[model samples]
Target: MTKTARLYKIERLIRQRQHVSFAGLLAELEVSPATLKRDLEYLRDQLGAPITYDRELNAYRFEATGGGSALARSTARHELPGLWFSERELYALLMAHQLISGLDSQGLLSRHLQPLLDRIHELLGPGGENDSKALMKRVKIIGALRRPVDATCFERVGEALIRRQRIAMRYLTRTRGEVSQREVSPQRLVHYKNTWYLDAWCHQRERLLRFALDAVQEATLTDTRAKDVAMRQVQAEMDTGYGIYAGGTRQLAVLRFSAQAAPWTSHEEWHPEQQGRWLADGSWELTLPYADETELVMDILRQGEQVQVMAPDSLRAAVRRRLAAAAALYVGA
Candidate 1:
């Protein structure tokens, strides 16, 4: 058995019997005398377990009442609170916790997530006991082009979303280089591609729209309740696209990735409804539904010459124009 499991069982056995002999503990834990003694010492010293041996009885038991660290106090006469977890499961939980904690460093979601993180830490046992920091050190998530979410804007948007209320905000559109005041009824907050976006019903446009959380310059909740868009409508309009740029119209976009990029692009999840096939020339052909080509074009351009827009003349033309404009920048230089 693992040391953690053995330690937990040893504590349970001693607590159940109120006083357990060394022979009984050794037999139950299936550990050598010295290993069992070391385990007991760790519990007593490092964990602050109030353990004392009775000379007359020749058995170990709690001090009836002893005070120390929280772990020590809790496990004084009881088992550890955290349920046993396999190494793999513990790693998954630890990675998720770390990812969430990292994203919250800007304080955007800190207030909302503190209680949740605290509960998880408690259930996982103390960081020292679990070696959470060591586990976290082995894993890392890198966001190549990441943006931070605004804390004040996020707080207001989250409150409005939870209450199913409308909010007024000044949002900046990078494409147009304009900041417009809008009153929108928030439907959901989406964190996609390491960015936070708000899917809402735009009062000015009289349609559903997506606004980046970071681009929200100002936000305030309104007394008006939000309009409820059906789940079916939301999925059809928003989820049918390649990325956050969604619309009512949907079209199939075919893309060809060269052999060099195929190794990575073939394994990528570009879209849910995407279909892919390997060509004889060692390239990959991918088909996906898209409503707006804005985000799709950006993804394609990021791959440079390794990707090509195979079909849908409009998308191809758009990409061609963008590449030409970008190439012109180096012409003079």
Candidate 2:
């Protein structure tokens, strides 16, 4: 029998019986003693099966506490253990891997996922050749407003988050031109539009805060344990508002997209709480909740004349001033 088929059979035999003798496996598999020994090792070590030799019984039996046999313990969970995937599933997973790999320029994500990816490639077989690579080349992912992050900072932040420990950081905000030292208990790491953010409990503010990973000048894991904030409070503090700035009162901002921009804006999801309608004039009207107008204004500005802030006098006024300032630059030139 082939190595793969024999391995599967060996697992089935051992699992079905209370104890399986080496001679029994040898006779059934019709393999040499050395080959059977190697197969058993592969099953125990690589597959994480808790197979132990019972010298008293001269047989192998599954240990009470199975180490990591996904196949043997498949019944406990509703998943197959043998790393099996359909061709289409493999393609989808590879595409996802490609998308993430392209966006992970810092190699932080790629480094951790390399093992699983390697296993997938092995499963695809040598016949696939460069299919995965070619498919990756065919797909492209582009990012806007992505910032480079220091490896050490990312590593330290990840460590603190995993250990539920506090992190000391030197953070720089674009609006404030100086670095501020902070001790934060990281609740979760967020990746939005290619930028990394940490939703954390700010020790100084005594409240939850969001810190952009790129703006983190320095980060060090602390010995202190992180203060646990309720999940509901975190959601209320961070997920209720539009975009990343979700800390304040959410205000509804009404926007009108010109007919020229309707094609693009019609399909876009501005926000979960957003309400939109198609106007008779071939234009689109959208209203979304936002805590801060800073990011919203930037997005609208990208559309140039195609978008107009129709309601909330403050937002409308803010957009007008920014546009005027931008237009003034070309006046003298």
Best by TM-score: 2
lDDT of 2 by residue, 176-262 (tens): 798899999999988888888999999899889899999999888889999988888888789877777876777999999999889
Name the lDDT value of residue 22 in candidate 1. 91
TM-score of each: 0.74, 0.77
- Across 1-333, the per-residue lDDT of candidate 1 in tens digits comes to 766666677777777777888998988888899988888886777556677887877988777566787435433664444435544465576677667756644756545656655544443445433576677777766765778877788888989999999999999999999999999999888988788999898999998888899899999998999999986776767787778887757888999999999999999989988999999999999999898899899989999999999889999999999999999999979
Clashes of each: 0, 0
Candidate 2, overall lDDT? 0.81
Q: What is the lDDT of residue 67 in candidate 2?
A: 48
Off by over 4 Å in 1: 1-27, 30-81, 84-88, 104-107, 110-130
Instruction: Give residue 82's lDDT in candidate 2 (0 to 100).
Output: 46
TM-score of 1: 0.74
Q: What local distance difference test score does each model get?
A: 0.80, 0.81
